[model samples]
Target: MKISNETKVGALAIVGITLLILGFNFLKGNKLFSKSLVIYGTYENIEGLTASNPVIINGFQVGTVGKIEPDPDMRRIQVTFNINEDIRIPNNSIAVIAPNPLNITKVEIKLGNASDYLKNKDTINTVASEGLLDDVMKKVDPVLYQVNKSLGTLDSLISNVNSVVDQKAKRNISDLLANLNQVTASMVQSAASLQSMLAAETGSIAKTMNNVSSITGNMASNNAKISHVISNLDSATGKLAELDLQKTLNTLEGTIKELQAMTAKMNSGNGSIGLLLNDPSLYRNLASTGNKLNLLLDDIRMNPKRYLSISVFGKKKTAEPLMLPQPDTLNAPYIIVDKKNN
Candidate 1:
């Protein structure tokens, strides 16, 4: 057949337009030759979700995202994904949007086991997966709030400190800081001095320590002597313990009582010793007798011729005995005399 050029050009244009439409739809993730199920999901926000994003089932590519747009109310984002018709999805399955390690967005259908399968254009439950960044942001939000609150508190504290610290108080604090520094310096100097002193005395200290060690060694070597002393002490203690101390104390108490009784008797003037100590009549009588004896001895020495009347020739014996002078009556010394001479 003879073909018109206009017809040929029009037919080429139609073929090109059809091919362009098919290519556009294929890029939009519409399966032209394969069967698929269209499912819908709604979210408050979809991050990085676009058409042609793969819909995965257990990490296997099942289909692709068909479209993503705000709903008619513009209040929610509606995502439409096409799943493979061969892959049965239960009516109760959930669709989740997640990110890959490379931060690529993906749609995963969590398959369910309900006997009734999901039909085409059915709405599935949607959940946004908590990615690393999302979790980090969630955790960082509270921390940031706490940090802000802490900063506010710190500001308030600084204001309070400023209000409390006047010029005098600041001066006092400065003085205290200076004094503390001086004390620290003094302590450092003292520590250095002590270190030098210890260094200088190290040999003496070692010698003293050696002497102490030698003394301890000698004590250890003479342990038998120490034991002997301890044994002697123990034996003495045993002997002292065996002694009748109570009986001895009782005897001593009895002796003390007797002495006390004797003292009481003496004090009461009941004994001869007490009478000798307390009475004066016997002493006066002894003093008077001694005086009289002394007088008689003096009289006899002076008047011996009067006291001794003696005859030279033999006189005739008289019947009466010659009388001697009585010392108390005559108050003179007595002497033997011859009767004829008298």
Candidate 2:
């Protein structure tokens, strides 16, 4: 039993065609031999979605999209996707059209907490995830709007400035600039003057510096004398600090209090000295007594024989006592005689 060449060729062609079909279907995400569960979902829009896009569960590929068509109501799109039969899907699970890193759209199944699994051909909830570009636009929209608003504001500000800054303001600004330039030039001149004044040998500043150096040198030469003086001052201060100033002050205070008391007593005319100072009658009496004493002294000097006998020649003549005071004269001695005798 031998096959003909034509039959062999036909068989080979059939086999090749079969392999090619299988390969194309495999590349299109069709599982030829495995059992798969088909599920349905409806979306308002399925812009990047197409058949053969992978269906994922927790980032693992479970199946692929099967078909997409407008619903019977012609209002929304209905998507058919297949998942492995072994991978159970809760009835409340969601199918989201998500973009991968490559920007390829896929069906990402988010499992729900329902205990009941979804049966074949059951509709799952579908959501269209915002693409990267959509998200970027969403975020950038506000920024662009703010930028435009700011530009508008800036333009308004520029217009207002243009209106407010007239020729007079420009002239003022130019005058301010000129003044600033003059001030700058003055500062430069001052700086140059200061530099010249700080010359090493010829400037007044140099002379002052030399004087200061000389003074410092003199001070350095007399440093030992200064130290000695400082030491003496320190010693004096220490001794002064060691003195019993409080006790001295207390003693002085006591003396001052006593003096004050004495002064108060004198002022009050309470003591003998106070009485003598205050009584005019006593003063008058003392003056009278002094005058009488002076007359008695003059009488004694004028008549010494009356008071004492000089010789033993006869009985000493008894001298009469002065009873009146005589008027004082420049040529005669001043005397006071008793009035009765005068």
Candidate 3:
């Protein structure tokens, strides 16, 4: 069959138009030559996210991103989107930015449970976040910039190091390695003597360990006797506890209280101790009497015959035996207390 050039051109034109329509329809996420719903959102920054990116919901691609523009305030990016119909979302839900198959940024709608579902034409909350690549690039951009600066500095440092090392060290480097080898060989020879000393100490360690085992065996054999003594001690302590401890304690406490009371009475001039403790006059009198008694004793010691004379009225007639004075009877009216005793 013979074909004209015009038919061939016309046929190719129809095929091209069909493919164009199909591509556009597919990009809009619809059947070839079919209609779709358009949704809108806003963003602060697109961060390399562009149109034709897949719009998704929790990772399910449901739509494609369309025309993106800056808002009137210029602080946010106003995004227009086309989504598949029959996909109702909640009003409380938000839209997130995701990436397409080519790692292209796109809008992904997230649906949270709400009181009422969103209609086909309903607008969603703007919660566009930077896509993974956008976030990664954001983090990497500064690091890359720092790395480039660091690489430049490192290059300068390396050049300096190369200038220093290449000049004279390269020539003597082999000599340094040779000297280090010689020192290592000498160290190995010295280590042999130290190894012999370590081997000699092993026998002493074994002997100490054997002595420790002997001591351990002795303690183990005496363990039962120690336990029996401790048990007997516990029984004796129990029996001791059963004694009239409370009565003894009470008696002790009573004695202590009485003693304290007596001491207090002494302080308040109420007992025999009171006379000695509280009366300064009594102390002074006792001191005076002691001095007088000391003087009388000294006189007697010097002239014993003067006080030992048995003659009456100082008329010494004969040296007779002396008799000691008797104590007064308690019932004899308490005897008009002798001045000396008082």
Candidate 4:
């Protein structure tokens, strides 16, 4: 057929426009040749979602967003998206706006275990997910607030310190620092002195240590003698341990009791020794008897023929028996003679 240039040009323009439209739609992720399932979701905020953004199932791009419109009645946004008809969406499935590594935001489908599938045009559950930056900001917000509060407190503390640190306080602090310096100097001197005192070849500490070493050496040298002495002591201890101390104590106790009983009897004046110690009349009688015996001894000495008649003439009629002692006179041999007896 013979075609005019105008018709040819018009046909080419139409073909070009059609191709352009198809290409644009293809870039928007719309399937021109295959049927797609349309679904709806309602959200309070879409989070910068727009048309042509990818719809993913387990990270795989399955479709694209179709439209986003606000619903005044519900005061929310209603989103429309299209997915491949071959992909089955459960009635209980969720759609979330998730972040991607490439900084692209997409709709992620979390499939559910519902036995029935969602039909076209049905609404899927939608959830808003926080972006990485949003999560980081959420975590950092409290810490930043605390840091700001701490900075404010530090500023106030500095103000208070500036108010309190007057000239007098400053002078006091300086004096305190000077005293501390002096104390530190003293401590350093003391430490040096202590170091000198502990020197190995000099100092009292060294002399004392040497003496201790000598004494220890002496002790070490006499270790055998010490051991022998210890052995002897141990043997004595063993013998002492074997002694019947209880029986000995009982015997000693009995002796003490007997002595106590004898002492009690003596105190009661019941025994002869007790009478000798406690009776005054008996002592007087003893003195009298001693005096009489002394007088008899004196008479015998003065006149021996009275006590013994040794003459051969029939016992030589004993001299008038001296029945009484002579009177205590100047001539009397025994001055202890009783005048009544005389």
Cα distance off (Å), candidate 3, residue 185? 4.7
**Candidate 4 lDDT trough over 10 residues, lowest sum:** 329-338
Model 1, 250-273: lDDT tens digits are 999999999999998888877787
Model 3: CA > 4 A from native: 1-40, 43-55, 61-94, 97-106, 110-123, 127-151, 166-191, 236-251, 276-342
**Residue 324, model 1: Cα distance from true site in angstroms:** 99
Model 4 residue 268 CA deviation (Å) reads 0.8
Query: Per-residue lDDT for 107-180 in model 4, tens only?
Result: 99999999999898899999988877888899999999999999999999999999999999999999999999
RMSD in Å for model 2:
15.6
Which 10 consecutive positions of candidate 1 have the poorest summed lDDT? Answer: 316-325
Rank candidates by lDDT, best first: 4, 2, 1, 3
Position 242, candidate 3: lDDT: 89
Question: What's the C-alpha lDDT at position 246 in model 1?
Answer: 100
- Strongest candidate by TM-score: 3
Give me the candidate number with maximum lDDT: 4
TM-score, every prediction: 0.39, 0.44, 0.49, 0.43
Model 1 TM-score, all chains together? 0.39
Q: What is the overall TM-score of model 2 with all chains considered together? A: 0.44
